[model samples]
Structures are given as structure tokens and as C-alpha cells.
Target: MNGAGCGSCHSAPGVWPEGEVGPSLDSFAQQTLIAGRLPNRADILADYVRNAPKYVPQSGMPAMPLTEEEARDVAAYLYTLGRR
Candidate 1:
């Protein structure tokens, strides 16, 4: 459950450090798509995390190869980061 990927670019509340390559997950659940097309559903997000290159040939996001459970956990965590 160490979804510390959240710490990669985001730190100390809403401040995303300058020069960070990845976007902040602080409001990820509110977003509509992974990279503008894929549904932002937990399962879909998980798949994207595992196979981003297959979905988008030229994406700057790299695949994380997360297990289905990990993806679900991460997605759940992301969902909670946004307002209801």
C-alpha cells in the first residue's frame, strides 16, 4: 500500500515543485481521462498504469506495471484526493 507515487511530484499540500515532469494527483479523480481519451475509471486507470505505451504510442508517461490490486488501491487513493 505504499502508493508513494503520490510523492513523486507532489509534496506538502498543493505545491507541485517546479521542474517536476509528472502532474500532481491531488485532484486526479476529478479529471475525465488518463491522457484525454481513456476513461478515468479505477480499472482503466490501473490498466493505463500497467500499459500506457500500448494505449498511447507517444505518451510521456511510462508504464508502472502495477498489479490489478495495486492499481485499484492507487485509483481508490486518487479518488479520495478529490472533492466529492
Candidate 2:
């Protein structure tokens, strides 16, 4: 789910150019917050990923509408991306 969707824009080896569209998740685990406001907790980020549209109507990000389980899985995957 998230792998297919987000991976389209964020694969490895320069697939996703670093810029304003969205920050790379490679270092997301180290970040203190998402979008510079929301805390960078796994659950919070998962919720945001599941329902980005509700929080920011004008955001270009599309809503994924993931189930709680899916969100948790994806968030777990993301958290593993840049772990030290």
C-alpha cells in the first residue's frame, strides 16, 4: 500500500529529488516533527499518512484512507528507514 504509493515518489538512488513536495523519509526517524509542526511519533505520522487531507485541505498530498492496521504497518516501515 504505502510502498506502492509513496515508493512511486520516494524510491532509492535519486528516485525522489530532495525538495518541497515532501521530505524524504530516509532521515524521518531522526526528525523531531513532521511538516515542522506535528510531533514525529510513529502513530502521529501514521495518522497523518492515513488522513493528510483532513488536516490540510489545500495540501497537494492525497488522502490514503488506510485502516488502522495498515497505517501502523506503514509507519513501522517508515521508522525503520533511517534507523541508527
Highest-TM-score candidate: 2
What lDDT tens digits, residue by residue, belong to model 2 across residues 22-78? 556676667787767788888788888888776677766677867889888877877
Clashing pairs in 2: none
Off by over 4 Å in 2: 1-4, 12-21
Instruction: Assess candidate 1 and give its TM-score to the true structure.
Output: 0.71
lDDT of each: 0.66, 0.69
The reply for model 1, stretches above 4 Å from the true place, is 1-6, 9-19
Q: List TM-score per model, in order.
A: 0.71, 0.73
The residue-by-residue lDDT of candidate 1 on 1-84, one tens digit each, is: 234353454432443342256565667768988878888888777777667788997977767757888777766766776757
